[model samples]
Target: MQILIVDDNNPVLEHIQSLLIERGFESVTASNGLDGLEKAQQSHYQLIIIDHLMPIMNGFQLAKNLRQNPNTAQTPILFMSTQDIGVIKNTAEAALVNALITKPIDENEFISHVYRLLDQNTQHQSL
Candidate 1:
């Protein structure tokens, strides 16, 4: 499955991409939210992984825009942040995000969330 990963941190982006590759999933990366938005619009991704704090646009704004587009309205969005889970949860819900992961990422948890979201997306598409 194809995934779109949006983050300003190069190492983080590379790490996530590597993990996904190890799992046999293909991914596209964007350095910031605006770039991410453009890329997201130009193609279809089974899942979108976004960083909460970014230049040009933030994850919440990106998610909002994505939700307004019919092409991406139902796409699952996974947000990554270093902020408090309670705060992020409130904003994530408002933005229609499917899940949130705290930074200093736990590889196991990250992959688990990825798998669960992808599986749910697959089932949703089938339905």
Candidate 2:
């Protein structure tokens, strides 16, 4: 599966990409929200892991834009941010983003969530 990791920090992007790659996922990355949006428009991906605070667009804006795009409305988005839960909830509600992950991520938990999501999606598609 293809996964996109969008974050302003180079380290964060590299870490996530490497982890996903090791899991056999084809990874794509963008340093800013605008780049992420452009990449998203350019191709289809199975999942998107986006950081909340970014230059130009920000994760909330990116999520809202992606949801508005007819081609990506059904795509799964996982928000990774340091934003407070209340803010996360408000932004998520506006963007229809169902998943929110806090920052300083735990490696094992991140992988577990990613696998769980894909497994669930597969099960849902089968039925």
Candidate 3:
């Protein structure tokens, strides 16, 4: 499966990419939200992992844009943030985010969410 990971932090991007690789999943990375939006529009990804706070565009805006495009309207998104969970959840619901992961992320938890979302996506596609 292919995943798109968008974050401004180099280390976070690398870490997530490596973790996905370890799980035998391929991924593409973008440094910011605008770059991510361009990449996402240009190709197909089974899942998109986005950081909440980013330059040019933010994750919420990215999600809103992606939802408006028919090509990506149904794609599952995993939203990551360093903000309060309650606040993020409220905003995420509007964006139709499938899952949430808080930053200072726990590796195991992150991978678990990734697997669950990917599995759900696969099942959905089959249907």
Candidate number achieving the greatest TM-score relative to the actual structure: 1
- If both were scored by lDDT, which would come out higher, candidate 1 or candidate 2? 1
Q: Would you list the C-alpha lDDT of every candidate in the order shown?
A: 0.93, 0.83, 0.91
- Tens digits of per-residue lDDT, candidate 2, 66-98, equal 899987777778888886756767643635664
TM-score of each: 0.96, 0.89, 0.95
lDDT of 2: 0.83
In candidate 3 the C-alpha lDDT for residue 113 amounts to 92
Per-candidate clash tally: 0, 0, 0
**Runs of candidate 2 exceeding 4 Å displacement:** 90-95, 123-127
What's the true lDDT of residue 39 in model 3?
96
In model 3, the worst 10-residue window by lDDT is 87-96
lDDT of 1 at 72: 96
Instruction: Work out how many backbone clashes candidate 2 has.
Output: 0
For model 1, how does the per-residue alpha-carbon lDDT over 34-93 read when each residue is reduced to its tens digit? Answer: 999999999999999999899999989899999999999999998999888787676535
